[model samples]
Target chain A: MADKVLMKGNEAIAEAAILAGCRHYFGYPITPQTEIAAYMAKRMPKIGGTFLQAESEVAAINMVYGVAGAGYRVITSSSSPGISLKSEGLSYMAGSDLPAVVVNVQGGGPGLGGIQPSQSDYFQATKGGGHGDYKMIVLAPASVQEMADLTIEGFDLADKYRMTTMILADGTMGQMMEPVELKADAVKTYEKPWAVTGTKMARKHNIINSLSLVPEELEQLNFARYERYKQIEETEARWEEFMMEDAEYCIVAFGIAARVSKNAIVAARAKGIKVGLIRPITLWPFPKKVLCDAADKCKAFISVELSMGQMIEDVELATRCKKPVVLCNRAGGMIPTPEQVLAKIEEVAGGIN
Target chain B: MEPKRVSLFAGHYGSGKTNIAVNYAFLLKKMGKEVTVADLDIVNPYFRTKDSEKELSEAGIPLISSAFANSNVDLPALPQELYSLVERQDRYAVLDIGGDDRGALALGRYVPFILEENNYEMFFVVNFYRPLTTTAEEAMEVMHEIEDACKMRFTAIINNSNIGNDTTARDVLATFEETEKLSRLSGLPVRMTTVTAQVAEDMKDVENILPMVLQEKYFDINI
Candidate 1:
């Protein structure tokens, strides 16, 4: 039986990580995400796990690097500004081919803008939150329950590909409460054959560092990561298509915004709008193939976000700009109400009709 | 930002409700409580608690809300945070519910789950000097709004009615009386009564007060 228990997004991730055998967590305090750190801080000690509150996000990410290098499942999370701080560590992890889980519970931002929900970080996450010729397998969770499920998947995928996985969430999904079935056996123990625990006799001396002085070596590492990414694209790209059958227009959104968008699609359909929703569950792989198929069927696409036209760019790219992609958004600690999204759908379908 | 606790602060609109929540969370951090405030204000954008993220974070009180949930950034989703807290045990969480019945309705969405998992006390902060302060009947109306909306009883009433610095013990008592009467009518309890320092020390007439302390984020609810 799937036990139903209401949980915040932050707590869901911790519980999921515990299920996925993530035994180490390093994080710093930042808005919209401190619950994750706080949760781990309390529970890790009881489970004989380590939860380190690093001095800053930068330090936290590096701490993740050290722990993950030891071949243990480790995770670090933060909001927009803090994610930016951890980018360097992310690049290092990607370069070293280490498995780690990173979650971005995004808030509104260009700078330290506001701690409101916004999807402006779409480009930042999919394009790479850090400076690198690399990609993190990013999963977009629209509900709190998914937050738990995906965090578990993130660890599994990371280990499978020797990759870093990120759960890209918006503030609403992070803060909202919904029933979830927590994974069992709060204590997670994993066997890391590659961990560098002082080169014990059980394994060879391992140097798990993200450094390659030669240009060709770095290029080879980048290509290897890309090949893994290609596999992810072929297999792990996921999305939910609602009422797309015989629909003239499709709305593309992710995270909590997508849930609200799905509700709007339902409302619009009730009003004879013939609108559909294409929710990209995996943001990094982008679900381009499904979207391409969706584009062939729909007249136009609407990119709904809490920020100005970030994910819309991807929609345009995915569809090869064959369809007109219109944008409707709100920013700076604001949520685009369901009515607002329905209004945009009405307008778009009016033009199509 | 701060420690995590399961708390909800509720009141009518324009009652300095958000301000009180923000300042109260700030004070809790100052007293060494690890607190995280959720701005579950889906109704209003103006006074949402997340507006003070920078300041609150600087004060060591991390704030999480609906706004921070996204796939691109690294904010902790509120559901994940809460569940982890329950799994881990002994963390403080505060939720700043909206101003009206709608806000309470929003809170109801999570009440059955969080309350069952972790025993939480919901506080209804009241200002006795406000428009509804004159009568116990009026006070019950607000409580009913919350009860109907949230589908849960307000565990306790935190009598916070005061007239700035001029507030007196008599005024506090009147508000407490009304809250008490409403509690009796509604079957909830007046868990604690808050009073200004000047009045707190002066009122030795009734000595066996359950337990009331300065209004701050990290105070012991058990005490």
Candidate 2:
């Protein structure tokens, strides 16, 4: 077992990306997420990796596209507003089927909100921030350890699916510190037959681009991407259920909200409320089946989020609105306290009888 | 001997000085001393002594921070109450200085008063794993820079070399020779070494072991 040392979430993600064989990192400095770029800038050179501070988030993601196209592991990170700027580049990567890791150390939304921690980018991350029928596999990490673990997993899943994978972290998760046991440096064996590395008189030259001018061909490409998405939804849906045995009410959350909801569930259970929590690790896959199963046994549901009920829509769709789904949220960089979430749980559990 | 009236912690970024300061404050409180932590870290907003306001308050230790702390605003507005605590000689106070010479400038503001009234020990925390201060000479240079910025001399050094989650006992001991060299170069004593609680238990025979509670962030609720 590796020794445990305390590290902030942003630095942990950077270290994990390096340990996952990521050699190229391109990112612009943004509040709540700048530590990642700073860490990479210092460690990347020492480890013989490339760290480029691009002029803008747009240039950073496009640089990631260029690196990923050449068959090397690459990454880029930014906060919410910077992520908005990277959308066009994200769309190009998705269209080209380039495998890369993009980390969203999410802050408050819409416009330049604030530098405080926020999880308001749920829809933007899971629904493809860029304009297209493309999807990026979104992994929501609740702890600093997961910030490291899921980053490595994000890289693996991106290469496995030939798509972009995002570590959807908010300000709190990105800034907090925890003990993380990083994985050992593993050998890379994954094949990248579609990489646009120089041909060198090889069998054929490969081209990487997202522009398909032919209408029928574009339609066919969209269909194939959707098919892969369907497979991911079936096989890659990841979630964790806590104290769900004979739970009469369920609290659904992800990321930092899920961490707070766990405390709320414990408090509620101490008072014999019979409430449990369902934490979605992969937001895009949505973990609909587990939610539906809990919906059958639970009398009510409370979707705890750091936004204005963004994930609740998925909770509702997952359960088909079979049971009442209430929302307990604080948006625009405000975090809901455990007491606040417990109050909502008590309210829902009170009406259950 | 009586405990030092004031203990100040200064270090580079990622040196884990904030964690050491928090743990030491609790240690003083547990000894039945009136303890107060002044959060002079106006540079980095992410992790600082101010983030543990609730914990400190719960432990009956008052935390004095900047006015706009833990917010998006980067104002270096120090609370007036800190001046009173620094003036008081009855209580033990821990001043958590921020990273780099820029952060040490916050401590420079109280230099005249600190030098006049209080008997304080400023600890220069050294973490070899950090990029800038990787060697004895580099660490000594940073100490001199911090002293010049804060207008105060460091009385002791704390060896806190550890990689996050990848730190080992060997990693901590690897810096002992260099830290000793640093102590000799700066004419300061090697005060103590910080390690995680788990590591501290196994290496109890090691002298001057400061067992640090891993308080990296505010949120502790993990499911």
Candidate 3:
């Protein structure tokens, strides 16, 4: 009661990262998530951590690469356009198997998008982020609590898998304030034997590089990386189901859309629509099995999103198109209202016109 | 007649200052005062008095925020409309200054006018819920920084500590000692302690209580 303090989602992420033993932070300022860098700037120096506002997003991510290569927990954050600048470094980190965390507090995108909440970066985060056969462990947090919790989870997952874990939150999550209880004492540590820490005349020097020119070697590397990704897929897919026991229709959403969908689901239920929600906490290793199971029982599925039906494709694939998956969305920073989503739910339930 | 003509609310980031400022403006409006809420926030890129623009406009209160607010301009430029706050002495000005010194820097230019008027009550909205200003000393450190940046010492305190949307009357009551301690340390009076309307009914006896009309969050956002 006394210790739980109000924190913006961005501040929660920053404090959670520090609590999770992340000491080196490098980032360029971008809206909706700049509070993270600002917070890090204020707190990092006092705790003997390095907080560098790099010359560019590119330089910031490369600094992250350097720190992660040295076996230290490090992070960098940016919005949509800033993330586009870090893709090359992200691919390099993936190619080198360097474990670190990246955060994309997404805004409306396709160029210099509007500085408003949008989940348009779904495909960019979960699918085509960097130019390689790579996948970031993308965690979508709907509330400020999850924003903190998942940042800790992201660091642990990155270390465990030796890859990049991304906290994919919309502008609402980044900007909104909530009461968050941050656990500062309990930090999980990992053994990074392959880290490029100094050998000190004992062990062989670890070489951290991504440029493997050999055809067969590069092929094996890709295969091996995918193998690790497959393990992650089988074990790590996470989602939340609400009122799903006898639901006739299922709503699939994540981040802010998931929060909005909850309101719609409750309203639809009151109207005898029998709609439920499956909110994915993990976007990359998406909760496909839940969607598949919902497809069996549910008559229809609605994909609620802040983009032009990006997650709908995943829903269709996950459900094998067994039940009709309709897209209920708003693009370019506009989020769908609960009334709009409830209308879609009623539409799916049987013409409640 | 109870409060001064000019009311300034400034504090640490996420200290519930912006919400408090908006609610205070509405209070002045309810009192049949000519109210103008000037959002002098140049640091934080988050929620501002701009969130309540439509409601304020409908209520006939002129709202002013950063010139580039809610746009893709990405600059921390102040609006020229800020001068109206200083120029119009008849209107009751409720200011929502930015968080900490960086945000309060924008208030420096207007400090001369506020001091010249000598009828302003600058409030340091204290929130212990924020990470940086948990202790009274730490809170005072930030207050000093804000005082330095704005060039005007806060004349009063507004204990606005609360968890967004989850604040209980018990939580508001628990900070009584800290608020008193802050008031004692800074030699400033505790003007009011704010709580949401839901909790106000339960704790009506609490002194100097200002029941806030909170902006409903995104979940309960009015469509």
Candidate 4:
């Protein structure tokens, strides 16, 4: 009821970031996610915010690192190839324990693969694309509405955990338009005690650096980061379960794949198949327990993805390989249709029963 | 009767211009008129009329887009096929212009021919529900910017003010006064207010209703 308006997903994310009190935005223009920078460029000037179109993806991400260390909510957005360039900054942000929001409007890629929508960056995003044993919390959004909602949540989560929170979306989610509500004004939810705000004469200056020369000190940093990651793994995993109460088969998917799978699940149900969906909204602290628990009730698991077979690995691990896991996918920017998914569902049902 | 030989839809970003242009082309085709869709969207990298090329081709409506249109290739190469939109007066041409003034620059080349022909209806698509253009004055600023950029003034206003898929009959009706205010402010007639087929039945009493089927954002069926 708060004056919903139609918005492209990338634009929604940009506006939502501004509402969440993000005063600084640095990003290079990239396909699919171009609107985010354009919107920020147009609106930021009017609202006393900084919108810098960096010379390169590396430059933009480091700019984010600088602004985030200054204790301001900041964001940067890019596609796959651009994200690759930002990987070094991502690792540094993680090691420095800086809280920032990163938006990956994913495009097809192994190396500048295509401009079409793709989820092939699953391994790169969740498995730590940058060097070092660091992790960034990843959230995948299925709808344009989710694109905005999760961006606001991304900033909050980043602040709460003091880590990089990545909103991993594909081109479809970036380009698609849907009715979404944006906050005119958002309340900042957390205080940054460890922020590198210039210390007054009364307090000790906070240092924000990734490098610790001492090997044991660096080892301790890694240990402490992973301990926090463990706490996140236990408490922060998010997912959506559809028709899962009495499911015989479970379809694990996220983003656009999950949306397509919903229709397939409904169609399969009409054809007398008891199939359900487990859409992981959070990819890093993946819904592992749900998958492991559903394995006891479900006979088979199917991963419907926009990649060749990336998330299927996580599905196998999360479910503890309790049942046969199949990959139903189309790579290189192609999306699986409801019919194709329904046929695959039928095939799995036929094989199991 | 034939509405106009060449119809150009221009507006603020997210004003539902491309979707309306697509629907208008199909309407012309359904009216038993030969139609062509010219996509002049060079502003945004995605969400262009070229996405419906297959359906339009199947419907016998030729589509003219950039050479790199619909590809991951981000080249903003304007298509040479755009000349046909200005030359062919025997058939209907529906143009989906890119958003805002920067987008309207693509229209500058064909403006002289279109003005000389005088057989065109340049529509200023307005959606008061959009974030920036929520008021008549704000919407007018976009109108003037587009006109200045293209050197062709809009002939009428198309009220496409709806909140995407969640739009209801009341939402459409709520914008009636504002659309009317935009019309009075811009000195342009309110051509028609579009409502989706889902809520069109409830909006029967409304005047100048142009009921439309929303854009097929997803694939596997309708274009």
Number of the predicted model whose DockQ against the real structure is largest:
3
Alpha carbon lDDT of each predicted model: 0.73, 0.86, 0.88, 0.89
Q: Per-residue lDDT of A97-203 in model 3, one digit per residue for the tens?
A: 99998999988888998788889988988896789799999999988888999999999999999999989998889988878888765568999999988999999
Encode model 2's per-residue lDDT on A1-353: one tens digit a residue: 12555677888889889989998999998888888998898789988999999998888998999999999999999999999999999999999999999999988766888878788889998888899999999999988889988999999899999999999999888877666777766424479989987888965989999998899999999999999999999999999889999899999998888888888888888998898889999998899999999888999899998888899999999999999999999988889999999999888877778
Error of 2 at B175 (Å): 8.7
Model 1 error, position B205 (Å): 41
DockQ of each candidate's interface versus the true one?
A: 0.03, 0.30, 0.55, 0.51
What is candidate 2's lDDT per residue for B86-174, written digit by digit as tens?
A: 77888898999987787898888798988897598889999876645778888887788888899999988999888765567877887
Off by over 4 Å in 4: A183-188, B29-33, B54-59, B219-223
TM-scores for all predictions: 0.64, 0.84, 0.96, 0.95
Which stretches of model 1 miss by more than 4 angstroms? A185-191, A201-203, B1-223
State in Å the error of residue A253, model 3: 0.2
- Per-residue alpha-carbon lDDT of model 4 for A1-353, expressed as tens digits? 22788888998899899888898999999888888998898889999999999999999999999999988899999999999999999999999999999999988888978888999999999999999998989999998878888899899889998999999999988887778887655445787878888778768989999989999999999999999999999999999999999999999999999989998998999999999999999999999999999999999999999999999999999999999999999999889999899999999999999
Candidate 3 chain A weakest lDDT stretch, 10 residues: A344-353
Ranking by lDDT, best first?
4, 3, 2, 1
| Deviation in Å, model 4, residue A160 alpha carbon | 1.1
Candidate 3, CAPRI quality class derived from DockQ: medium
Q: Which digits, one per residue and each the tens of the lDDT, describe model 3 over residues B1-223?
A: 3878999999998888888988898898989899999888877665777888988999998998887776666777898988998999999999998878998998888888889989989889988778888878889999999999888999998888787667788888888888889888999999998888888998888888898887656574311
> What would the per-residue lDDT of candidate 1 be over residues B35-121, giving only the tens digit for each residue?
677776655433356556777788777776664433333342344454443343455667777756766776766776676765666
Per the 3 Å backbone cut-off, how many clashing residue pairs does candidate 3 have? 0
Distance (Å) between predicted and true CA of A319, model 3? 0.8
- Return the lDDT, model 3, position B113: 86
